[model samples]
Target: MSITYLEAIREAQAHALRDDPRVFIYGQDVGAFGGAFKATKNLQKEFPGRVLDSPISEDAMVGMAVGAAIEGMRPIIEMQFADFSIVGFNQIVNQAATLFWRTNVPCPITVRLPFGGTEGGGPFHSQSIEAIYAHYPGLVVLTPATVEDAYSMLLEAVAIDDPVIFCEHKFLYYHLKAEKLPSEALPIGKARIAREGRDLTVVAYSAMVHEALVAAEELSAEGWEIEVVDLRSVKPLDTDTVIASVARTGRLLCVGEAWPWGGVTAEVIARVASEGFGLLDVPPQRLNAKDTPVPYHPNLWMAHRPTARAVAAAARKILRR
Candidate 1:
């Protein structure tokens, strides 16, 4: 049977709870409600007291996790929606993120965010918040696009003695699947070449990775070999791998579901232009969601986020330059 991206996450948490005595899950409705997306489905029943429910306050949830981690416990905090994470902005960026650096005690906390857009989620429910968390130091921001990465990276996040922002795309929870969970995975902070090509490179992460691959396939039909890079971790971005890909392709088009202003796409283009400027034949281009709050209507939502069609169009435009 095929395992989905959401199932992979549940399995990873089960593994962590089974193996680590200090590991526990705490969040709003996670214990009994199985999380907003059922990412914690039946985990409370399986683990019993290990999974606990908290109040609706995101700030309080993260604060408690930080305290628990300080006392030698590994706490996983689940944010129902990515946008709601901003409610705990202070605790995440200041308290949890700076705890270890300031006190020399490892803060092992994992915050799972059900990120990205689904049709009709609107501005409040649908937002790509990875770039915001990635801006801070002492926080490991992960964007898992595939089932394997969703499983393995989460396990790794629990193992690391640092605050981690696990950004799992809500759209991929049921849409993407793998034949089976992986026994091993690429190390964190590494980028995977989803599709190899020589004409141009499309650097993307999370849900956008699949879009990039689809764009690559579409372009391939027209004799354009497009390379797609899946950035597993944004904070510890693998610039070397991205630079190497750009060197071979001689063109770059960064794609993301987040808004254009200072998002991951902008970061990728900036890095390629600064570190690998000599490797490009044309100026690096990027495609992102419109610079407005995510829309509620299905048609507007579809137009708001980057898609296979938009990515392919952007790639073609960059290629022609």
Candidate 2:
């Protein structure tokens, strides 16, 4: 049985609500309209009052979730588009993420971001903003790639006691196909390997995981066996697994849709170079979007970001070097 990205997301929401009374969802068009991408489709009818349609205010939505978390309720707040999340930066970075540090009180909330490009969502709705929270001390960021992950990690995010930024690549939502998981998964700081090889290792998260896999396949066809590690948890990056993988392959290529300036790719490359340099055959390479704002035009947008071919090219060059 195959599932679409949007369908898997909705299934995860239902699983959370049914498994935990503390978990609930609230966001713009989340109730009757079923969200901008219909990820919350029919949830309002299924959960009734549990699924709420919030006002068109990201800040208020985040603050409300934070307040609820302080009172022992686990609330999952959805940003219709990841780009709109900037409006709630104060609530996220200052209030929600700092709650435990400030008063030793954990903020049990999840900020769900339906992020990434390929929808031609234009500049406003397309840019990946994981870098915005990359520097924040307490924010736990997680991105799910496959359908099993999409269905399970939401449960993990809801179970965590700290604030989480749950980013889902919108482009992968309906396009990807896979079997479903049983919907019981652990916390927000977990990573998994999607493919295994000994020649080179490609690390990525969210939609970039697919790109890495395609890149691996292409390289394999060319007699270059490449491994793909999905760094699902961006914040508490499993450097142990990444380092171990790099030790086996002796080469690494990190891929992400974030800007090249201060993206997740930069963080990954730095850690690999610093901690895993002894095991490397060549310098750690990274694949990221250009250091510019997302473009409105589709052709320019496609050219600006890293692709499967681009990742394969980078991986091959690193292997050769």
Candidate 3:
């Protein structure tokens, strides 16, 4: 059946609650008011206290989830915004990520962060802070771009015993809609080549995947066939899949809705340059958000982050250069 991005996420949470008695979701506004983005709407009524509303404390809430996970209960902590998760830094990078190696206990904490720009949320709410968690050593990070993956990946995130920070592009929440399999799912860590070509490969995830697809369609009209690779799981990285695609394409364009410097694109570019260096025709290029805070004005915000035209322009130049 056809479902929107937000609906798919809700379905995933509902399905998980129904299937796993140990799995319980709790976060800010997630229980009473549904959620900041309504992702957990009706969950409280559907599962009662299982979908709990916590006081406004990102760090404390995350710590509680970690504690619960270690005690054999699967806790999913949803940070209202991606930037809000920054408040939980020490608990995440130090405690949640290091607990397994520090001792032998499994801390299966899943922190869901809804991210990216929309409605001029200013610097506070709309930050693409994936790099913050991506830099952590023991954390598993995944961002979903499609309806099926959005619904399927949550289950995958909960199944793994490791600490996971799943970044959901909130801007794409209402925009992306598709027919979802009633219950079938997709595996985590396997990057799907959404579109295939030989001239160049565009490796991107989250909202940028939609941008890259639009760019690819425009480029295809002009005779340039670009391959689109979605790095479904970024932490384990699926480097082999990216390298193989670039081996045939000869060029790579890594794009994302975060700052170019230390964002997700930076890691992808580094991997391709390091592992697939000799096979590339030119140095891999990156299309990403500018190295600055998101502005309030619509025109300025449009100019700041990478768009379809920007990605298409970069692809054309990379293909020729």
Summarize candidate 2's per-residue lDDT along 100-198 as a digit string, tens digits: 999999999999998888746788888799878868999988888877777778778788788989898889888987776554554456678789999
Using TM-score as the yardstick, the better of models 1 and 3 is 1
Enumerate residue pairs that collide in model 2.
5-173
Scored against the true structure, residue 313 in model 1 reaches a CA lDDT of: 94
Ranking by TM-score: 1, 3, 2
> lDDT scores for all predictions?
0.93, 0.87, 0.88
lDDT of 3 by residue, 111-149 (tens): 999988876777777788878788988899988988888
TM for candidate 2 is: 0.96
How far does residue 78 in candidate 3 sit from its true spot (Å)? 1.0
TM-scores for all candidates: the values are: 0.99, 0.96, 0.97
> lDDT (0-100) at residue 101 of candidate 3?
91
| Cα TM-score of candidate 1 | 0.99
Instruction: State the lDDT at 9 in candidate 2.
Output: 81
lDDT of 1 by residue, 199-312 (tens): 998999999999999989999999999999999899899999999999998998998899889888888888888989999999889899999999999999999999999999
Clashing pairs in 3: none
Ten-residue region with minimum lDDT total, candidate 2: 180-189
